[model samples]
Target: MSAARGPDVYVGLMSGTSTDGISAAAARFLPDGDVLGVELLGFVQQPYDASQRARLLAAMESGSARDYCMLGADLGGWLADAAAALLAESGVARADVRAVCSHGQTLWHEPGHSTWQAGESAVIAERLGVDVVSDFRVRDVAAGGQGAPLVPIADALLFAAPEHWRALQNLGGIGNVTVVPPSRGAVDPTAGVRAFDTGPGVAVIDAVARRVRPQLPYDVDGQLARAGTPVAAVVDALLAEPYFAAPPPKSTGRELFSAAYTARLIDDCRAARPTATDEDLVATAVSLTARSVADAYRRFLPEPVREVLLSGGGARNPVLVESIARELAARADAPAVRAFDAVFFDGEAKEAVAFALLGFLHVERRPGNVPGATGARGPRVLGKLTPAG
Candidate 1:
C-alpha cells in the first residue's frame, strides 16, 4: 500500500456504545512520530438529539438495510458537526486540518469475521472539506482477529512506564484492558502490551439503572449503588456468563447485553429475592463489572501487572471505582488503581484521541492494529480513507 502524506493536524470523532454524544478531539503529532508527545489542540462534545439517539438504537436492535444505509450518512453529518464544533472552538480553518478521523458509531462487532461501524466517511469528508479515515475495525477483523481493544497500541505508546507494569483499562460501554509491561529498557514497549475485553462495563449497569430510574440516563456517580447492598447471588449469576470465560483478543458491546436482556435479568433477580430494590440491582451490576475485570486478570494477564490505570466514563463513578479497588485488593498481586486523566491524558477523551493517532498513522502508512491485542495475522495499516473532493 502507498503511503499518504502525513497531516500536521487532524480531528478524531468518536461515539462509543453509549450513543450519548460525539467526543471530538483535535490532535497534532510531533515530527518524529512520537505519540507520547502529542499536542491536544481542542475538545468538544456534540450531543445527539433524543430522536436521533433513539433511531440509532432502534437501527441496532431491529432495522432494515435501508435504515442502516441511511442512518450512516445521518450519523456522519452529526459526527461532522462535532468536528466542526471542535475546529470552531479552536479557530482552526478547514483547510488547515489534515483529516477527520472517526471511529463512528459501532452498530455490530462480530469478531474474526465482521464488525460494522455506522457513519459515512464520504459524507463527513464532503461536508467538512477534509480527508477522512474511518471503518477502523474492519481491516483487523479481516486479518482473523477480534479487531478490538485497538487503543492498546496508543496506550502503550503514550503511557509505558519504565519500572511499573501498567494496565491501561478503559471502562466505556464495555471494559477493555491493555496490560503494558514495564519498558525493561526496550525502545518498543508495545511488544509487552496484552489487551482484551474484560466484559460489560456500563452497558448492563446502565440498562438496569435506566429501568429503575427512568428519569436519569444512568446511575449518577453510582450513588444509588453506593447506598444499597449487592446481592451475591445476582453478582455470581452474571459473572458465570460465557463471555467472562472466553480468552483474550475478544470484544463485546450492546448486542450481548441488550435492554431486553437486562430486563430479563431484573425480572429473574426480583423473582428470586422477592424484595429487591432498584439500588440493589444497580449495586449488583456494579459488582458484576468489578468481578469480571478481576476474573479476566486472574485468567489471562501474561505478566505480573502492578498498576491498573483506568479511562472512560466508568472512571467517574465512585461506586464502580471502589468496587474494582476492593476486588483487586483481595488478590495477592494487588495493583494500584489510578485514573488515566490523573496521570497521562483525559479519560473521557482517550478513545477520541486514539482515533486521532490512528488517523495520523493511517496517512503515514504505519500499521495500527496490535497483534498481541487484536490477534490479527500481523501488523496492518487500518482504515479506509475518504478524500475531500
Candidate 2:
C-alpha cells in the first residue's frame, strides 16, 4: 500500500470485547506528536442482533477451523456494512479516504505465540474500494512477542509527554495499561516496552450482567455491583491464576477469562453463601477487575506512576471506577486512576485510531509494534495490506 502524502486522512475501524457496535474514526496524523486533525467524524454504532452476537461469541469461545472461516466472512460483511453507514453518516466518500485500518474482531488471542482477529480484510477492502491494513498482531507474535496491547505504540507517539509519567489504561472487554515513561527517546527499537493484560475489563462484568439480568446490556453504572460486597475467596482464587504472576511480555483474552470461568466463580462463591445473590457475583467480578489492576501496577511498574487515564466501556462504570480509586489511594505514592472524560473517552475509538496510526507508520516503513511490550526481537512493521481495485 502506498503511503498517502501531505497529512493523509485514514479511517480506522474497531469492534472490541463489548461487541456493542463498530467504532470508526478519521485521523490526520504526522510522525511527531502533532495531530493535524481528528474527527469522531463517523461515529456510528451498529449493534449485532441477539443471534448474531451469540454466533460471534460462540465462534470466539470454541469453534472448529471451518466455523472460524464462516464467522470471519460474516464478520467481514457486517464490518463492511458498518463502514458504509459510518461514511454515509459523515458524508465522506470511499475514494476520498486513504485506507482503512481495522483491528478485526479477535476470536482467539494467545499472546505467547499466535493470536487471531477475524473480519476478512478482503471483504472490507472490496466493499469499501480502499486498501485495508489488517492482521496486525500476527507479525508481532511471529517475532516472539505478545501480540497485544498494541495501543502502546500509539501511546508512545501521540500521548507520551516528557514532563509527566503517565499510564494509559484501556478498559475494553479486557483491561491493559501502557506506562509512558517521562523520557520519550529511551525506548530503543530493539528493546521492547512494558505492557500486558492487567485483567478482565467490562468483559466479565458484562457477561455476568447479561446472564443475570438478561435484558440490560450491562450493569449500567455498576448498580448491581455497587449493591453487593466482594467475595474474598472468589477474588483470592482468581488472583492465584498463573497469568497474574507471569512477568511482562504477556497478553490474555476471554479464552482465559471465559463464561466457564465465570461459572466456576459463581459455583465457588455460591458454595460459601449457598444463595449468593446475582448482585454479589457481579460485585465480586468488579472487585476482581479492579484489584487485579492495582496488583499489576504494584508488581510491574518499577516507579510510582502519577496518573492512570482510563478509556473503554469500563470507564463508564461508577462502581468499577470507585473500586479502582480506592485501590490506588492505599499506596503512599499511588497515582490517581481517573476516567478519560467524555472529550477523551475514545475508548470506543482508541483501538481503531491506534491501528490507523500504525498503518500510517507501516506505510512509511517505520516500525509500529512495541518490541518491549510485544516481546518481539526488534521493531517490526505491522499489518498486511490489500489494495483497493
Top candidate (TM-score): 1
Total backbone clashes of candidate 2, pairs 3 or more residues apart or in separate chains: 7
Of the candidates shown, which would achieve the greatest lDDT relative to the real structure? 1
Instruction: List, in order, the clash count of every candidate structure.
Output: 0, 7
lDDT (Cα, 0-100) at 26 in candidate 1 = 89
Which ranges in model 2 have alpha carbons more than 4 Å from their true place? 1-7, 31-40, 183-193, 342-345
Q: Write the per-residue lDDT of candidate 2 for residues 1-389, one digit (tens) a residue.
A: 99755436678888887777677777767544332124445566678888888887898767888988888988888888877887888887776777888888988887666888999999998988888888888998898888887988777766654566778888998899988766545544223346778989888888888888999989999999988888988899889999898898788888888889888888888887777899999999899999999899888887557888888889889899899989888878988776665435456667777878887877777788887787788889999988887
Model 1 global lDDT (CA atoms, 0 to 1): 0.85
C-alpha lDDT of residue 367 in model 1: 90
TM-score of 2: 0.92
- Candidate 1 per-residue lDDT, tens place, 28-133, comes to 8774343356788888878777799898889888898788888998998999899988999988777779989999998888877799999999889888889999
